[model samples]
Target: MEFAFDEADAAFRRDLVDFLDRELADGWERSEFGLGSAVHTDFSRKFVRTLAGRGWLTPHWPERYGGGGQGAWQHFVLGEEMWKRGEPRGPQYMNVNWVGPSLIKYGTEEQKRTLLPPIARGEVFWCQGFSEPEAGTDLAALRTRAVRDGDGYLLNGQKIWTSYADGADHCFLLARTGTVADGRRGISVFLLPLDTPGVEVRPIDGFVGDHSFNEVFLKDVWVPRSRLLGEENKGWDIVRRTLAYERVGAPRYARAALVLDGLADWSRTRGLLHDPGVQEQFGEARALCEAARLLVYRVIDERAKDKEPSPRANQARAAMVQAERAVGDLALDVMGSEALAEGSRGDAQFRNSLGAGIAAGSYEVQLNLITRLILKLPKE
Candidate 1:
């Protein structure tokens, strides 16, 4: 289906572009740092609050949920402009990509009323706590358990690779509510306040940045029963949807587009595009980016049609994930050691591509999801 934005959408994009241009001026654009930083500067948070005050944060969420009450198309246009300008999307992305929609779908009305406004206003930061020591790739094998108590669930387990856990106000985590025999059926989802007693957060340093990931240790932490998302023993199902929401809806592909545009600009100045080999590689990168764009649009079309879009989501996620890695590899070929520069986010596409394959789910795991869920191929 054709997914171009309407005239109204174009106007919306223009307004957002203008606002961001003003807000992210000299000494201010740094507000758009990624999740894995060791420190999130006050200026960045202030910029997010500014965006929130203007009603642009979580723009895709329902009107009743503190969102701008926009449809998906309005968002696509905004993302395109922001990413093309090499802007920061972390806060807005996390709010719209997974958290807001997840809360709307499964949270209690009280939870919705309590969380949505703060999230949209950028008053609260949320982290994802899903992968564990033994459950990174095999998420169903997670062993963190939440035992039902009188007024809350007692949590005792460790979640590794939690993004922004240190600075976050809360976490959306998956904990076991039953035994191994129950497989994925015994999982429970909860929104746990990071300040709760018995919860300890340890920061992890990653290649490009810190605050990009963390290790969270929960020891008999008490989370009120009201924090449960959806029903008990239903978290695995919730996660399946949440993961899809994260992978498909995030503006990852748009970021890739921005980096590609950078690569083109760099090549023009360096006279690299005139080289036959460089030109050929550049064409390949552009084509891959367009393919990713098409995949993203397909999923968006499915959403507009009110379909679950699970398989299409898988396709888009896998394609975009691979595209990041590929863009880096191509950039390395083009820039070589110069790709190691410390400025401008460290080689732009190359550094991002280097991490893209390993971030979220590995490209291997994403491929597995596409193969099993989308292709429905027979297993050995």
Candidate 2:
């Protein structure tokens, strides 16, 4: 169980870091106009294309799918660097992380031929349409329906808190195809094009930033059978695997760790590092970040070995949420008023930490999973 990176992986990280230093020389910031804002997405579209050109966008995918055919550790390295630098890839992270892989696993050949290339080229944006007004953490409760209509299905429902919907070209949607009594069995996954008729995207103002959330309305939106991912009424398995991939997708601890370093530097510059209280805060936050990083690495190791995603993914995601929250708290405690400035590192970290607890399944949900699956505790 060697934890250190081999020379090849370490060299890849060095090259990636150098490239990012040059690319983000202007100090890339996600807080400038929010992630889904025109300004941010426009930058992401261009930046990701550049990454694609470097064969860095989907390096872990098979080469036939337009990836570099690299190992999973290499892909994880890319994620850590991107997240630390504020994830310039924006919404495309979903495409590379799970969306494309899900398609590769379950999509028809035509579906793969049509969709995989665009994602590999970084020419598209995608959003998840899983969360509904009635189904946030309880995704099986989603009521969005897709009824059989000739060769396609007519979809009607609403999805809320859809991140980056304003910039996405397509949606990885979930809808109920079976009767309401079926619960999770009733659900189906759809690769829906946003331009389809009767689909509307409405922006929602959110504390994170403008356009960070949206309401996606589907009123008799027609999707061809070709767009259905895997088998209808059997999407729960796909969702489970997709969620596993998503749990450690963002590498939030990398950014949190980077934020901790910044705070330490800030403290040192202001002679605040001498204070025992501030010192303890920084040390604790740093420890949390390291612990979270190692937990995530455990999950990635499973992935590298092609193991089924386990409860460790849930534990890793929960640890990342804690690490982010710890660093966010340290920022405000040590930097005080300076942490409150709009678009500042502290402000951005605080907002990201809030989202981290909720995204990729909430922290509480992860604990429930840990209890049931890892600890093998009976359900309460």
Candidate 3:
């Protein structure tokens, strides 16, 4: 009957909130600028180091990998608090959530020794080179090629919409190692250092915010075979699992809930709280946020128990997208023109929600996955 955090977790939450309160007292705003913006990334580099010192950056990872050796719930708790404040950890969240974990599972011992420590220490930034112009969520359609060369592979292709690429030290890149006919079976993953001889990163301006996307061109970039992750042609499995982790990685509902609270305060101040329609909107948005939170918790619970990720990740991602959209709609509907003011909660939430449906995996993709994986619906 009890659905509350246990005593220890509750206490941990209290302590973490206190720490975040002090740490972010200086008015650090991620909504005004995107997470990939120079301002945000600059602060994150300094801030994440503090978290690393506290053993919070990689608490869920193994101790040998420079983590605190905590359980998954602890990690989820960290994510929730960070997300509530627009995720001060920046791109490093990818490292802690899925990237580093992927390496842990598939990286060679040398890779782990060389890579995991820097990530756990918050000394590096990573970008994903998954989606290309030809491939979005359907990763199998990627055209980037990595041909076998003398003791390495010659990587040549371009990746679009690579977030954080401008600031990244490395990339978790996927390339085709087989013929186009091979589909998903022929792809391979590479731990690509961004400074490779033929790699070029170009910034792209987007409506979401500044520096939110980039294009990475690989012109016959030579990567030693040692940089390859897992086995060639076996990257699909890693991608699948890594994506499941990334689906619910951000604890987006936490920030959505925070925005909802701000909306409530804004409503209360404008005397709109007494309006029945406003009340209904607030109630609906709150419910959606809570639903997302619970769904994400279910996924985290499975992780805590060491269960293989399932369709629940898709369900959770769908709920989060719904929650984000609902809160954004509520902000605009309730606050009207005031919500459109730059850097306001409404403005930020609306802009952020627009991307929520598209990021990670699109909301429609999650629905398709749910139909096939959870509901067992036949695809026509």
Candidate 4:
């Protein structure tokens, strides 16, 4: 259980730090930018292109796919730095993380040729069509259906709480290709164009922020057979693998730690650092953040070693949510009314905390997984 970074890793981290400092010099804070805001998304488009140009984007991907062919740790380092700065790459992070990797693994040759380059070049935006009005954590219950047509599928369903759907060029969509009773076995993944006929995106304003979520309606939308990712009706395997990557992708602990630093700075500046409660809260949040960082590192370590995925990913994700919520709570407690104002650091942390628990599967779901899979506990 060696935890120290080797020289090469340390050098890479230093270079990444320099790159981020140069790129985000204009007061970039992770919490200040909303996920769906035009300012953030637009900046992300350009910023990720820059990363691609510098060969920083998709570094962990195979070199044949326009990546640097670096290891998983490098990719994790990039994610941490980007997340620490509020993920300047925007939605493109999905491209580099699960989507592109899934495509590389499961896509047909032609599909990979057409899709992988643009993602590697940071030229596209993709939204996930996973959650629905009725099916969230219980994704097997999703009702979105893609009935087989002559040479394609006619998709008719609605996806709710879809992030970046309004601006995304494509959707990593899931639809039932079998009978409803088939449940998880019935699902398939589609690389559907968002602008296909009968597709509609309606914005939903929620606690996170404007443009953070959308309701995507597909009324008899059609997709060609070529767009199907992996084997038809066997997408459950693809989805499970994708979710495994997504569970710990963002390095949320990095952002939480940054928020803790900001809170400490604020406390010191306001002559409140001497307060015993504030110090104690900061210590607790800091400890949680470190715990989360180490837990996520363990998951990454497993990936680097080519080990089988385990419930430890669930543990890491759960720790990250806990750290985020702790920091959010600390921000509100320390800042009080000032934290309530929109766009403030405290407000952003609070919103992030709220969303962290819900996004990428709920905290409760993670606990259930840990109990069943890790603890080997019997269900009542």
Candidate 5:
């Protein structure tokens, strides 16, 4: 297949690169804190609004929703550039990538009117309430409940590993609206306002860093029936499809490749590029990054063609995790003791690589999907 970008896409990339260079010429170092950091989030709020002003924040969404009506490839191109520059858009990436689109597809007309504009304007932050203390990975087993109460639901439960919850305005939350034995069939999605009464967000200190993860608790939080997304007891289908887009949403391999370039520059400056083992490792890491990029592009190509979401997305996500880990390892090998320094490129890469495998879905879970779907293997 041809890999060359047409003139318009090439021009778009050039313009986007120029825009990033101009906007991030100073103080962009704050983004190195990684997504969900107070530093990163603060910078992103302003940066995303700037992008929205330029009509680039949600370019793929329809024009009626305040977007530019661009295609998926344009959005993917934007993501690649942002991720390569360490994703200065912060949590707003989710707002454009899957959250707003999911709302467009499943939200009520009134909900769409109320919510989509803020996201398109880059005026809000949203956190996903997916993982629970006991229900991570195996999401269908989640126990967070939303009981019927008059015309609304009373939500009560806890969600862990919730990124960006500390400063979020709303949550794309999932809860069990039916019995536990109903598995995936029991779940529903809620567009929960974080400031609602009885809602609490507690920061969790972890390896990824402070403000990156939190535990969100709900105690008799009242949510109007109008807040429910899609249909009750039918959220699993929406989650599945949303995860498909999300799997390749971040263009993580783009960041991995950029990190690899930095590692190479570091090696060359230290005259370590001449080492045979170091050279070999560099070659392998570069190969993995390129492989991951191509795999992701394949998934994006399918989306551009409007093909059904395929197991190829799972394969692409798995490759991205491997690519990130490989580059992270290479940084440690090249940087030696300096790699341990906080905020160092190697140190940041290592932290990001650790989260890459676990976020969205675990690497092991992606392998299970590839085996069962791509390889057509029977379950044990």
Candidate 6:
């Protein structure tokens, strides 16, 4: 349980820092929840390809898959440096995070052959389709349906709040293949080309949504049975497992840590850091951030040892309340009057922290898991 990085990891961190220095010196996102949208311009896409060429884009994956084949610590350190630099993470996220892993784990050998290399090369863009209009938190309650047809399945219904749908080339999806009465029991996971005939993506606009999501409709869009992941009706199991890995998303704790650092720096410059009241607030936030870092490390270690995070993962989510809220509150403290600015850089961090609370999983549910599920408390 020594929290210190061993020599090997220390060297790996140096390698990561050097790589970041070379690649992101031009500019990039540095936090896990790094602020702002991608330029998504041609220049940006080519810049991502340059990362691919350097073997830095998918560093978490094995080398055979066009990655650096590095360990989690190296990946974590690389992310820390990138977000701290205020640069966008680029397409590396969808590839190295969970999209490619899920496909590699559950896809057919042919499917893997077709999908993985392209994703690793930054040739394709992907988005997730787990949450439906009615089935976000209770994923099993999803109402999107898929029915067997001639050579494939006819997909119908809609997916809401799907991130990056407007730009996605494909989506890793969950659909109801059976009766709603079957609930989580009847759902299955599938992959779809977003431009498949009969499919429509409608941009969802709101004053505050930041355009990260969309409403997607599938009007008999067909997917070949070759696209079904794992066994039918057993996708619930895969979904659950996949999501555990997915939850990391390069570790919210790491990026949120940056926001906290920014707040501390601002406070010190403002002389608020010397006040007892402000110091207490900073100390509490710092404690939670440290706790989150340890909790995440435990989850990684457990996975490396081939165990379910289970209660530990639950604990990580619970601790996220402290981290995410503290970042949001930290933003208020940092920007003060500027926290309300929609276009200011500091205000952008505030908005992003506000979004972080609801993204991945809402903090409210995490609190319930900690108090009710983990502590074994009776429901109110």
lDDT per residue for candidate 2 within 129-214, as digits (tens), equals 99999999889999999999999999999999898887789999999999889999989999999999999999888766645788
TM-score, one value per model: 0.92, 0.97, 0.98, 0.96, 0.97, 0.89
Task: Please state the error at residue 241 of candidate 6 in Å.
Answer: 1.3
Candidate 6 TM-score, true structure as reference: 0.89
lDDT of each: 0.75, 0.90, 0.91, 0.90, 0.90, 0.71
Which candidate gets the maximum lDDT versus the true structure?
A: 3
lDDT for residue 261 in candidate 4, whole number 0-100: 93
Q: Tens-digit lDDT track for model 5 on 1-380?
A: 67977777778999999999998856354235577677778889999999999999999999998899988889999999999888899999888888998998899999999999999999999989999999999999999999999999999999999988988999999999989999999999999999999999999887556458899999999999999999999999889878998899888899889888878898899899999999999999999999999999999899889887889999999999999999999888889999978778888888888888988789999999999999999999
RMSD of each: 2.3, 1.3, 1.2, 1.5, 1.4, 2.9
Clashing pairs in 5: none
Sort by TM-score, top down from the best: 3, 2, 5, 4, 1, 6
The alpha-carbon deviation from the true structure for residue 364 of candidate 6, after best TM-score superposition, in angstroms, is 2.2
State the lDDT of candidate 3 residue by residue for 1-380, as single tens digits.
78888877788889999999999845455366557667788889999999999998999999999999889988898999998888899999999999999999999999999999999999999999999987987889999999999999999999998989988999999999999899999999999999999999999987666566899999989999999999999899999999999999988889999889988988898899999988998999899999999999999989999898899999999999999999999999988998888788888889889889987888999999999999999999
Q: Kindly give the stretch of ten consecutive residues in candidate 3 with the minimal lDDT sum.
A: 25-34
Q: In model 6, how large is the Cα lDDT of residue 378?
A: 92
The TM-score of predicted model 1 comes to 0.92
Worst 10-residue lDDT window, candidate 4: 25-34
Q: Weakest 10 consecutive residues, lDDT, candidate 5?
A: 25-34
On the 0 to 100 scale, the lDDT of residue 147 in model 4 is 90
Query: What is the per-residue lDDT of model 4 for residues 201-266, given as tens digits with 9 covering 90 to 100?
Result: 998887565467899999999999999998889999999888889999889999989888988998
lDDT of 2 at 379: 83
lDDT score, residue 131, model 1? 91
The clash count of every prediction, one per candidate, is: 8, 0, 0, 1, 0, 8
For residue 379, model 5's alpha carbon misses the true position, in angstroms, by 1.9
Error of 2 at 173 (Å): 0.5
